[model samples]
Target chain A: METDLGYWIIPLAIIGGAIRVSTPFLFVSLGEALTERSGRINLGLEGTLVFGAMSGYALAHLTGSPWLGVLAAALSGTLFGLVHGVICSLPKVNDIAVGIAMMILGMGLAFYFGKPFVQPVAPDLPAISFGWWSEIPQVRAALEVNVLFLIGAALAVLLWWMLRATRVGLTLRVVGDSTDAARAMGLQPAVIRTCATAVGGAFAGVGGAYLSLYYPGSWNEGISSGQGLMAVALVIFARWNPLACLGAALLFGGAGALGPVLQSVGVSEGYYLFFAAPYVLTLGVLIATSSPTQAMTGAPGELSITK
Target chain B: MPFTSLSRRGFLTGTVAAASASAVPQLGFAGSHSPLTIGFIYVGPKDDFGYNQAHAEGAAAVKAMEGVTVIEEENVAETIDVQKSMESMINFDDAKLLFPTSFGYFDPHVLETAPKHPEVRFQHAAGLWSEGMPTNVGSYFGYIGMGQYLNGITAGHATTTKRIGFVAAKPIPQVLLNINSFLLGARQVDPEITCQVIFTGEWSLAVKEAEATNALADAGCDVITCHVDGPKVVMETAAGRDCFVCGYHANQSPLAPEKYLTGAEWNWAGVYTNMVQTVLDGGTIDNFVRGGLADGFIKMSPLGPAVSDAARAQFEATKAQIMAGEFSAIKGPLKDNTGNAIAAEGEGFAEDDIALESMDYLVEGVIGSTS
Candidate 1:
C-alpha cells in the first residue's frame, strides 16, 4: 500500500498512463490530422475502431500472434474506410451521415464476429521498460510500459515533420484549404481525400488494436469506452496537429488516472466527477481555443464541422 | 455357451418377439401422446460465455435427455423479432416447452406470445410469471447471493488490502443482488472490508471490464470479482498483480489459472433435464419452479488450483451448511450503506420475503450508490 513517489512510481504512472491512453488517440488523431489536411472529415472512425478491434483480435487468435491482430485490424479498418469513402464520393450523400452509417455497420459486424472471441487468452504486446537503471521496484513497475505508446509518439513526431516538410503534406494542405485551389494546382481532390480517409481509418483501427492486444490482452464487446469518439474530439482539441495530439492524448490520460490516483491516496467521494474529467477538460479547451464568429476561422476552410 | 445358442428358426422367432416386446411399451406410450419438443430463444449469440451461453447449455442438456427434442434459435433480439421467432417455433417446430431467456423478452412480446400458445409451457428466466397463474407460463431464477457470499469469503480471506472490487454490467436487480451479497459476505470475514463497485452499464463488454479492472487495481483494490458475462478481463489483468478474482456464469479458471479463486455457476443441466422430462411425461405444468443448491440447480464452480486446501474445505463446509439450512448466507446484523440495520442480529431473511425480489440498497461495506 505504500507508494514511494520519489522512487519514480508517480512519474512512471503519469508517463505510463499518458502512453497507454494516448496510443489510441495518437493513431486516431494523427489519421484524422492527415485526413483533415486533405480536406475531408471521416467521423466513421468510431465504427472503424470497433470493427478493427474485432477483426484484429479474431485474426490474432486464429493466427496466434498479437502483431497479426494489428495487421488485420489495419486491413479491416482500411477496407471499411475505403467502402465509406467510395459511398461518400457519391454526388449528394453527406460524408458525416455515411460516417454514421459506417459506424453502425462496423459495430454490428464487430459484435457479430466477436462472438467466438469472448473467452480467449490472446497474446499481449511486450512492454519496454525505460527505467531499468532505477534500483527501486516501484520505478521498475512504473517504467514497465507498452511499446506501442512509444511507437505512437514517434509516429506523431514523424507525422509533424512530414506535414511541415513533405510534398505530400503540401498537397494535402492545399486540398484541405480549397478544392478549387487543389484543382488549380492540377491535384485531384477526390483521390487525395479518399486515400486520406482510408489511412485515417487505419490509424483508428490500430488504436483499437492497442486496446485489445496491449492494455487488455483479449477482445470483448466492452473493449472500448468511447475512445474512438473521444479521439475524434481530441483531433479538434489538437487543431489537426500530430504533436499537439500527443500532448492532448497524454493530458486525457492524466485526467483518466485522476480517480484512481485519488482513490489510492484514500480520497473516494468524487470519483464520478473524476471519471468525467477528461471529457470536461477536452470540451473546455475546445471552447477556449475556438472562435464562434468566423465560420472557418481556426479550422481548415473546407472542413465539414467547422464550416 | 451351447445352451445359449438357438436354432435358426427359433432365433428368428425369438428376435422378432424381443423386438415386438420392446415396441409394445413405446406403442402404448405413443398411443396417447405426442413427442415432447422444447425450444430455447437466446437474447445474445449463444457463444456469449455468460447468460446466453448458460441458457443454451441448459437447452443442450435437455436435448441429450431421452424423448426430449430441443430446438434453439440464438441471437433472438428482444423485439417484434421475438414474437415472430416464437411463432415459428410453436407452429413449425411444435415446441410444447419454450424458454425465452432474457429479461428484455419478459414484457409485451412474451405476454402476447404466451397466451396464444395455451397448450405450450413457457419457462422464463428472472420474471415472476407462472403456468398455473396463467395456463402455461413459469419463471425461475437462482439465489445467486448464495454463490456470491461464498465468493466473498474466498476474496475476503485472500485479499491483503481488504478492498475488493466488483465490475458489474448494470445496476439491474440481479447485478445489485450479487453486489450486496458479495459485500455482505466479505463483511462477515472482516467488518472493515470495503467493496468498490463500478458499473459499465452494458452487458459483457470486455474492454470496459478490463478498463474497470485497471481502474480498480489502480484504486488499490487487491481482489476483484465481477457480475459480468466473462471473467477474462478481470482474471488476466489481475494475475501477478497480487490480486485475486472470481469468475461469473461459467468456469473461467483456464483464462487466468493462478488468479482465479472460485466462481458462482448456475448448473442448468438439472433444470433443463427436469423441465424437459416433465413435458415428455405430459405432466400438468407447474406454475413456477425455483432451483438452487438444494435442487442442485445453482452451484459454485470448482475452486482453482491456486486456492489453498483450507479455503476449498471451508467453502465446501459453507456449501453444506447452506444446503442443510444451518446457514443463511444473508442472515443479519445486516445494515444498509447508510448504517441503517435492515435485518436484526440472528434473524435470517425470510425465504418468501421481498429482500431478494426488490434488492435496491448497497450493503454496509459497499462504497457506491445503488442508483
Candidate 2:
C-alpha cells in the first residue's frame, strides 16, 4: 500500500498523536512539578524513566502481572531519586550535576540489570473505553485513548487543586519559593526535597512502566526514545503548572505523531523532518515563554535551571 | 532490583577481584543428558529485527529441538558485571553451554571462564577463539562479506553519484572486512565506485548513527551501508532524502523499503543449531569453530523489489563463485582509500589478511581508522 495521508487523516492523526505523546509527557512533567514544588529540579528523571521501563518489564515478565511491573518501576524510580536527593544534599554537590550523574548511573544500572529481559511478552495495562457514549467516529477515536490519558488528565486537575487548596501543597510551594523561608517556618528542606524527589521519581517510573507495560509490551534499548528528556522540556513549557503540563504534553504528542500520520497519507519523503517536530515545538515554546529579565512570570524563583 | 534470591544465594562470593579469580567450577557437571540448559547472553535489547533479534530467533529455533532448554539474558552490558552473570549461569543454573554473545566479552571473561569450567561448552558468536584443538569452546561467524558484497553490488548499480558511504561502530578488522568486501563488490560491478566511511566509535547510538548517516548523505554519498545496529534511524532518516541504504545484520527492508536496496542478514539459526546438536550428542565441544558461508551461518537478505533483475542475477552468480572458492571477495588488486596498492595487482590478500575475523583497512573509498 502507498504511504500517504489524505486530508481527512490529519484531524484523526492529531487526536491520536496527542493521546500518544501526552501520556509520557504528563507523567514526567507532573513528576517534575512535584519535585520543583519541593525545592529540587531533577534532570536525572530521564534515566529513571528508562531504568523504570527495564525494571517494570522484567518484573512483569517474571511475575506474570503488569501491575507488579508498575510497582517495581515505581520502586526503582523512587530508589534512584532518593539516591539523587541524598547526593545533592551533600555539603558541596551541585543538584544539577548530581542529577546528570544520577541520570548516567540510572541508565548504567538499567542496562546492566536489563540484559536478561529483551523480548519478554508481559501483560499490558488494561485500557478503559470512554468512547462508548460517543457516536461520532472522531470523538470516539479521541475518547478511546489510553486509560493513562484520562488518569493523567485527572491527575492534572487534582494537582492544580492541591497546589491551590491543600496545606501540603502550600508547604511544597513554600519550600520551592524559598529554602531559607522554609527553614524559617520550621520545615526540613532536605527532607521535603527528598520526599518530593521520591514522589516525582515514582511518577517518572510509572511513565516508563506505561511504555513497556501498555503501549509497547516489551523492553528494548529504544523504548523511551528521549521521552524522559523531552518531558523535562515540557515542564518548563508548562510553567511548572500541572494543568498546563497536560496541555503541553498532548501538544507535544500530536507533534510526535505527525510522521506516522503523514506516512499513512503516502508522504514517505522527508519523514525524519517530521520526527523532529516535538523537539522543535519544545524548543520554540521554551524560547517563547522563557524570559531572561523576568523569570518570575514563568518559573519558580529558587529553581536552578530558571536562575 | 534483580531477583533477590539470586544475590541471596551469593554465587558471587567475592566482589573486588573477578578478573583474576578462576571462575568457580561447574558443579554437578557430567556428560550430556536429557535436559540440556543453554544460556544466551545478549549485548542489545532483542526485537530490532536485527542482530540480537536474529540471535534470539536462532535460540528459539534451537529451543524447539527435543530436550533443550534455552535461557536468555537480554541487554547484557559490556562490563565487569558480565562475569557475575556468567557465574550465575554456570555455578547456579548449571548451564551446559554458554553463549556470551558479544565481541568485547571474548577476552578476560570467556578466556578466563574457559579454563575454570572445562566441562561446560562455551560458544561465543563472532570471536576468533577457535575450538582450539579441543578446548570445548568455539568461535563462529558468517561470510557477512557475502551480504556486504551484495550490498556493495546494489550500491554500485544504484548510486547516481557513484559515491557510497558506510557508517560503522568501530574500525575493527571485522568491520573493516565488511567495508572491504562492500567496496570490492561494488568495484566488481563498476570500477570507478568510491566509498567514504565514518566510524561513530560506539554501537547502537541512534542519534549518533543518524548524524553519521546524515554527514555521509551531505557529503554526496547517495548510497549507504552500516555495520551499526538499529539502522532504523539511519534508514528512516535517509528516507526521501535522495539516499539508499544497504542494511547490515537483519532484514531491514521494511524500515525504509523504498530506499533500502538489500542487506546482510545473520543466519543465527545455523550456528545455534549446530552447537546445540554437538552438545546434545555428547560430542567434544572444540575450543573454536570458525564457520563461514558454507555452514549456512552467514548469508544475505533478499534484495528489495527495487533491485534490477540483472543485478540480482549477477549477485547470485558472484555469491556462487565465492562459495565455490573460485573467487574470494577480498581477493584483489586491492587498494586503500588513497589508491595505494595494499595487495599485489594479480594476488588478493591472504586468507589471513582479509578473512572475516581480522580485516583492518577501509577499502579504496573509506575515510576512517580502525582504532
Task: Please report the candidate that would top DockQ against the real structure.
Answer: 1
What is the number of backbone collisions in each predicted candidate, taken in the order shown? 7, 24
Say what the RMSD of model 2 is: 11.2
What clash count does candidate 2 reach?
A: 24
User: Per-residue lDDT for B105-144 in model 2, tens only?
Assistant: 7777787767767878888877786434337667766667
lDDT of 2 by residue, A40-123 (tens): 889999899999989998999999988899899999999988988888777777888888888888888887788677533566
TM-score of chain B of each: 0.85, 0.87
CA shift of A85, model 1, Å: 3.4
**TM-score of every candidate:** 0.83, 0.63
Clashing pairs in 1: A222-B205, A222-B206, A222-B207, A222-B208, A223-B207, B130-B137, B131-B137
lDDT of 1 at A122: 75
In model 1, where do residues sit more than 4 Å from their true spots? A1-18, A87-94, A130-143, A251-278, A304-307, B1-45, B63-98, B104-122, B129-136, B184-192, B350-354
Worst 10 contiguous positions by lDDT, candidate 2 chain B: B13-22
lDDT of each: 0.75, 0.73
Q: Candidate 1 residues B32-149, lDDT tens each?
A: 4456777899876676557777777888888777776778887677798887778678765667788998877777787777876788778888777634456577777777777888
